[model samples]
Target: MASAIKRSRTSFLTALSLGLLSFGISSCNGAWRQRIGIEKQPVAEPLPEVSDGPRSAPLKPGDNVIVEAVDRVGPAVVRIDTLKRVASPLGNLFGGRAPIQKQAGQGSGFITRSDGLIFTNAHVVEGADQVSVTLPDGRSFSGRVLGGDPLTDVAVVRVVADKLPVAPLGNSNDLKPGEWAIAIGNPLGLNNTVTAGIISAVDRTNAVGEGQRVPYIQTDAAVNPGNSGGPLINASGQVIGINTAIRQAPGAGLSFAIPINLAKRIAQQIISTGQASHPFIGVRLQSLTPQLAKEINATIDLCKVPELNGVLVIEVVENSPAAEAGIKPCDLIRDVNGTEVKDPSQVQLAVDRGRVGEAMPIVVERDGERLTLNVTPEELPRQQ
Candidate 1:
């Protein structure tokens, strides 16, 4: 969600339904895609024909896209096992278990580089005392965590092996909602599990967590525990997204994946610098519709909103980039970097893409006057 992506400015007022995987990853379940209930799943919709963009080809009636995609990328998927030291109260008392017992966790990941570099979720290797990476060919290696960006839930783990199988990363920006989505992972300790569905949505953002900034891809593909950090490939047999977490709606639990576009950017940084930087210009935003604008004007007396549909700047964080740029409360954000932003998510996406210390120009309307402001984004505070 935008709330989790690079200090994304908040727009929604309601609580998000997503259960972020950074906390209490149960051993029975893995990390990211635990199943609350599967028998109660909603009926699947009819499958629509999809194009693979540049790789689009005519599909024969007997052509199995899932099998084809798996054959191409399955060898690169790996099972990750973590051993964390946990403090136990029954520290060898009365023949009980010893103190600081070893807690094990299971999750999935894929090799993104030929030089033993692996891509996985931050939660998977966050507190692990030791990480064991097992390949499909029965090869295991002790993994070293290069770094992890918890705000984005992206991490990079490297092994000493050479010439690893690399899964091809696709352009997530080219993914359409109706395109075929194939998930390959180790779910519920089932290694090399494959699931097929369609891409339900893309650019899925909202309040997921306080500091997590992930443009999640929504899919009907089943993701259970131990599926975290696995690749959600496209029909072209390319990694379009990384199966991250699930958000439970009414009767169904919607599986979500982090877009490869965002994941690759964060992953590259982790590979190079062992840490990631998230640019932030702190400002609380709320998308305003015509009816919402009328209500705000009628009730809110602090500042009257302009008669336009755009993102309304609610609160400019103190000493933030928005404050340094003289952005004020009740300002209607109209444009950023020559692009008109109608929703808070768009603004968040723009700000997230901006490089740290770069001067980003913004246009906001206050009292019907359009004022252009130059905001120099800074690294988000690490505490959050």
Candidate 2:
């Protein structure tokens, strides 16, 4: 009986030992599998919920003026394409008939009236045998040049279209420097390109090119090769100026535009008479300077003359209005039509406001005496 009991105890101990070793081997395998990423660990509980706080108000439609202005005026901008005939160099070498080649050019313009009247730069359609206008909707039409003023670089083109979108004209005289200026045009053949900048200056004269009497609005906007004649809009989506010339050369950021006030006047004249006219005084005038005043005072001895701040006449054309009115060289123009004159532009503006055949009363200080002279201005002769 004692031996059987001892065998039973030994068997029980062996069975317990076998159970413990099996559990240890299973645990070791599980650890190795976990370390090697062959088995996934138990997932942890989720984190507590947290709030991000209250949301702010949504943005208003008027928050973005640029986008609004573009949406308002962009459709009025048009692309102008011109084709001109050019003589081919190879024609001379071939000893054949002078070869005629079609030269294609592209520019920009804006509709000024709902009757399909468009305003653009004169140089855009100058010498073009054919002109084509393309709207933002991809519709193209053949355009006819109504009139062009090469002096102001303004031109009017008409298209036979109804219900055309017209850009609203603004008072350019009310424009102040540092205001927002938006330029929309096809630049470098890229249609509907928009650029933003500030009005760098106003009344910029003689900065664009020679013989431009109208004061130009200078801006830093990216007015490129194809942006000419496009509208330069204000923040209210009003057309303030017509983009015209860019300062060409390296480091070029200076861009100029014809003021809308002057453009409107010229366009009106062109529409009414099929030609624009400018008032001519028939004299070469120079702005008076301190040195020039001293030199004149020394030479002419114009005693009792008040502080000189006026334009000095350099030369007068023969049989011209200035010559007929006895306006000679070295005469200082003090006022025009009772308006005090300070610069040549002021005088120009006064003369521009007068009728071609109307008498213009001009005050000149000569030999220490201020003399009033009545001169009748004539229309400037058109260039041949």
Clashes of each: 6, 0
Instruction: Give per-residue CA lDDT, model 1, range 1-384, as digits (tens).
Output: 011111123345321111001123363454223456623434655422111223424333356767877877899899999999998888878977877788999999998777788889999899888999999989999999889988788888889987777777788987888999999999999999999899998877752653246778999998888999999998878888888888777977789898988887887677667788877777777767777777777766676765667887766666677776787777888888777878777777677777777677888888988988888787766764
Candidate 2: residue pairs that collide: none
For candidate 2, write residues 1-384 as lDDT tens digits.
001111111111110000000125886898899999999876855421111112222223587988888877888899999999998878767577678888999999998777788989999999899999999999899999988888788999999997877777777998888998999999899999999899999988767543346789999888999999999998878788989988866776888999988888888788778888777767666666665556545555323223456666655676676777777666778888778877666677667767676677888888778888887777777779
lDDT of 1 at 23: 20
TM-scores for candidates 1 onward, in order: 0.81, 0.79
Error (Å) of candidate 2 at residue 92 is 3.9
Error of 2 at 22 (Å): 99
By lDDT, the best candidate is 1
> Which ranges in model 2 have alpha carbons more than 4 Å from their true place?
1-61, 95-98, 248-252, 296-309
Q: Flag regions of model 1 displaced more than 4 Å.
A: 1-62, 89-97, 207-212, 249-252
